[model samples]
Target: MDYPPDRDSWFAPLSLDLILKVLNVTFFHPFIAWIIPLSFRAQTMHWDAPPMLVSIAWAACLTLAWIAGVVNHRLAYGLPRHVDLSDEVIVITGGASGLGLLIAEVYGMRGASVAVLDVRDMENGEARGVTFYKCDVGDKDQVARVAAQIERDLGPPTILINNAAIVNGKPLLDLDLAAIDRAISTNLLGAFYTLKAFLPSITSAPDGGTIVTMSSVLGHLGAAHLTDYCAAKAALTALHKSLEAELRISHPRVRAVLVEPGQLSTPLFHGVRSPNAFLAPVVEPVDVCRAVVAAIDAGRGAHVATPFYARCAPWYNVLPAGLQVVARRLAGVDFAMRSFRGRLPVGENGERTE
Candidate 1:
């Protein structure tokens, strides 16, 4: 069941991101930049030559930039906590399929205690070292019950990845009240329910813990058709900020990671079109999962954004309202959801369809 190497070829294909990645590893690399000046000097070129001076300066700049990146991460996240896979227990909500399932499988195969809470049955009918719990994260009572069961069976969870999400990709005028409520409950309230149920256990664990929130770029730049979806994501982002601030003062040992990815190549956004594939390619779930896993494993807080464009989405908020509107129209953000068939039906399993 090996999937083709889509991610590797995806980044390799012609795109602005690929160009930057190549430059970063070659011309922009400090070691590679330094080699240029050294080679010129070896060829009997004078150090005072314009090319020599430029090369030396470029190399120094690259070195400084690399060091600054390290310093910034240190100041932002502090030191990383020790993480031993054998002693860690991970709880992932909505791990039946897509990104959540990918991460759950990886951790399970690595021998870490893994629990997946989902209303849907395991997509692959359960994997070795992974326990499946039939619980809807959108339901507080269900989440609480599952939390207790997980603790009793697999020990207190040290890593909580809040990845459950739903989208109602319809215009505000076209959406029904039920759709709006469902989007908010599943996308926003679900995270709160999980935190309420698991935070105590995480705090009580001797080794500390990690909480990962799955957010989206739409939260920063709301779209027309995805009103409810965007609103819920926006709330989630704000909640993550408030939670992190509180944790910083009360429990600094506990880490929080926020993942803000662009449109994903999953059924959640199936039939939707990307306005600019070269600049904003739809991200694969595995790419997002890899970043989440890395941040959790390092035991440091992180702001993970994928496809490069997502990292710049926040800057759109600083633009003038008129300009922002124009950008949205140009990017086809509002029209992107003209066609969206969700994973489940409207009333099935006490969940909403979008």
Candidate 2:
């Protein structure tokens, strides 16, 4: 299988995420923050001294903020469910390659029964515990048939990852009706189809199950030459929220995880460069895989946003229209897709190379 070529330079690794990662462990960490004041005291610094006072205050603020963050998480997400890999039957769409493949391989290696549903064959041919099913999610009949087959072959699926997607790098005016239909069908309606086909089995399980939606930051911030893609993703975000709300009431054991990542170094968006590499660096599939795996393993519903800019994507909508346009110009959000050369020429059926 051919992978996307790496075009990043030595400095590409020096992104804001890298800087913040270091700061998080060293400065922002509550334990490390307190260490500063303790170190000052070890040097015989008076408690009321300017330096000591400042260090103590900084530590106090960090500690309080950390506690608040924990409280907020608990209040927002509630408690996590129990997860046992041996008993899990996992299903991942678009597991033929890229992010979905990475996740399938992870669980496959960990002794879980993983079923991969995709229109194409698995990129690596095979995996240890993964069974590949040739199914296009955009086709409701295919999804329905595959769901039944999976239940028979691998038992009821306890985890479902809706990660299948395709990019049609064309402006709205340039896109034909077929292209628009394919994009929306595959990117948005596909999730609905899969959920409808599999949710019954998932909900009927004694331990319940998890549903993961793979959205994008572009969903929140519409970009040029990606009208169909953006619109589909935006709808996906809404679908995820509504599904979560319904599951919370109907089946409290069912978990819903939402992942909205920035541009990833995958063939899905090959040749699309970030306008500001430091501030909006391309995300890695592995980074996203880690977050998804962590949430599933912990049996918790999470709002996973990769790359710092992705987490801030929601605020873009709240800004004034004039400021929004200025910010878009500065970030080159609309221009980013101008050079987009996706994995391959997508068909009207939304065929994806990765």
The TM-score values for the models, in the order shown, are 0.93, 0.95
- Candidate number of the best lDDT: 2
Which ranges in model 1 have alpha carbons more than 4 Å from their true place?
Answer: 1-12, 346-354
> Count of backbone clashes for each model?
0, 0
Q: Any idea how many clashes model 2 has?
A: 0
lDDT of 1: 0.84
Write down the TM-score for model 2. 0.95
Candidate 2: tens digits of C-alpha lDDT, residues 1-354: 244455644126789999999999998888998898899889998999999899889989998998898889776666888899999999999888899999999999999999999877787889999999988899999999999999999999989999999888997899999889988888999999999988988898788899999999999999999989999999999999998888988998888899999998877888888899899988888999999999999988899997998999999999999999999999988888877767655444536444
lDDT of each: 0.84, 0.89
**lDDT by residue for model 1 over 258-341, one digit each (tens)?**
999998876566666667778877787888888898998888889999878899998998999999989888888777776555
Residue 297, model 1, lDDT = 83
